[model samples]
Target: MDVTSDEVEMETAPVSADELVEAMRQAADDAGFDLEPEQLEVARRLGSLAVGEASVPAHLYLWGAAGRGKTWLLDAYFQALPTERKRRVHFHSFFRALHRSIHEHRTAAAEAARATGEPGAGARAAAGAVANAVDRAVEDLLDEVDLVLFDEFHVHDPGDGTLMIRLLEALFSRDVSLITSSNYPPSGLLPDPVYHHIFEPGIAVIEANMTVVELAGDTDHRRSSAVQRRQGFSRGTWMLTGQEADDELADLGLPRPDAADAVTMAISGHEFRASAARGGVLWFTSAELLERPTSVGDYLAWAAEYDRWVLDALPAPEHLTREARARFVHLIDALCDLDVELHVIAATDRETFMTAETLGRGGFARDAFRTRSRLALLRTVG
Candidate 1:
């Protein structure tokens, strides 16, 4: 196949690791995300090696606690890149695309077998067709881009486990660079013991080939704005009786309560439904919060949609394990970074919510939790 001029240029253009690192720093600064010196150094090294025609490392695994700006930095790096040479995709979205491609191929193969009158050939033909479809999808993904940036690299489904290993092998063979960010270390992913070995080869490849950089720092940039809000904040405690709060919310142009009793608002092109739970609290789900990029832009969009947020229940620390807790903190940081104000009306005391047993037992280091907890308090108050 004749590669496009753009692809040729990507294949030949020399990308400086240091320059890319500097660009990332500038981008972070532009986005108001503070980067530590060591983090910048690690990014510089990765940038230096991330591009080039040599048989570079097959995979680069960037793992850290949430709210450390891993995704932001990676995105900054990706966006600053000459667009023709890179592709950035969330794992879930990519997998869904891949799944659709697989299904299409299977359907085509079954039709071909039927037209040929090949008795009992549909199953085998479809299987081969699916494999070929996956291979082609992988090829196309690599063909146009030298570097693949996968955000939120996670393996919840066993089927995806097999696909990921295969996909990485193919990309490595093609000399395409893979950069991924995840909440879990490579070794700790896909924790089901039975399927753990499926991920081992990919993990080993990443460890040997790419530099594993940890973004260690104190500030949760996501919460910075919320902290600022709390620093110079004062709000009267106004009790809105159920009817009064409802009427006030309605007057503010929020959705009228549905027959099913859900208050729905559109935020950043996504719909979020909040329902009054016990003790007059409102609840938002993780699925709702993570449906789109939780960037500053998105947060501003959300602010226009709803005047006030009432979280009857924040994500309980117990609801998440250590890895999950870190991820949530990162999300909260993103929300804070966007200046999304939160108001919680809970039956439980603030201390009880802040110091839940789940919070204590989760494997987060004390210092990290302390920093995050302070931010959480600020967000709740706002």
Candidate 2:
């Protein structure tokens, strides 16, 4: 849970948002994607801002329902920007890196205090190191970047509340133009009534500095008959018993490991038994994935090593323990972000599998819609 994978900030050329949208239409014409009017209008506005033809606050925060093309619009805009000093990072990856960097910085400072000594991820350290560590983390992430785009931005974890505000302060202070794609608006982040206050300051920063845009729509057009491709996660299967998935696995030369010979695997720093394991392939029961104190960082670590993941005996979320159910939702988010395969053998039908939530007052309901939308990228069979 200590390490997470992130897209390295890219070094590339820039174009205008409107031009990028035109290119998208041309390339994806086969999918009948004309570039929705709502998104196009947003693109023009972004282009205007890029050219100084329009003035907004500090940046943009595009949010609304899942499948509303918030990400698509942001991605296109990223490619179209006029400066080469832009970087795009998945927020979770940045978060993990920031955490690791902070710990390292803190430990170093504490060690300096040791002889002066230090406190670290693997070492002993001091409390004054915390503030200095955060400062260093912000500097490391921002560097010379003039613009940054953070995808899937949300604040569900109260632990991230203060960190989020601090990071935002650094970005705004450095005049880093920001764009984010999220299912939640600034007000909706960290929606748990108990924890929402923790993020209120960060929310205020977002509301004050970013132009909030809503891109609402019905229907996930990506799952339309014309667009869904047979690739990546789509190459995976969801079925009753995983028989079809097994055959495909074997046919592709990575046969599933037998349950009797469960394989012990190391994720980040923890050890757990997989239902089976082979070359870049791993199998697990839903319990194996969800029942423990595993985190999204752990999921990402394994994903970096394995190309395929098979999850069996996936029960209804309502039937799972609160912690277990939350892990499942996090697992989905992690997998969706990676270029890996997920073959699910559900204990219930897809309807129930998709709709079920952990029985609780506060959980991952906010993430469910995004989870289902991304899961649609994969092919499902009854």
Best by lDDT: 2
How many angstroms is residue 38 displaced in model 1 relative to the true structure, after the best TM-score fit? 3.0
Give TM-scores for every candidate, taking all chains together and pairing residue i with residue i.
Answer: 0.62, 0.85
Instruction: List model 2 lDDT by residue over 1-382, tens digit each.
Output: 1323232344455456657666555534644567677766766666655532234325888888887777777766665454556667767667777667776777776667657323352234546655666777666666666667788888889988788887788777775677788888899999889899889989999998888988866766644434345666667766666567567656767576666868788756778888877677878887878886788877776877888888888877677787886787788777776657888877776556656554455444656677777776666665
Error of 2 at 43 (Å): 1.4
Residue 39's lDDT in candidate 2: 68
Give lDDT tens digits, candidate 1, residues 187-276. 877766778887888777667766677777776554454433342111211122345544544453443344476666654456666563
- Assess the local accuracy of residue 322 in candidate 1 as a C-alpha lDDT between 0 and 100: 57
Q: Which ten contiguous residues of candidate 2 have the minimum total lDDT?
A: 1-10
- Model 1 is weakest, by summed lDDT over 10 consecutive residues, at 231-240
Whole-model lDDT per candidate: 0.57, 0.70
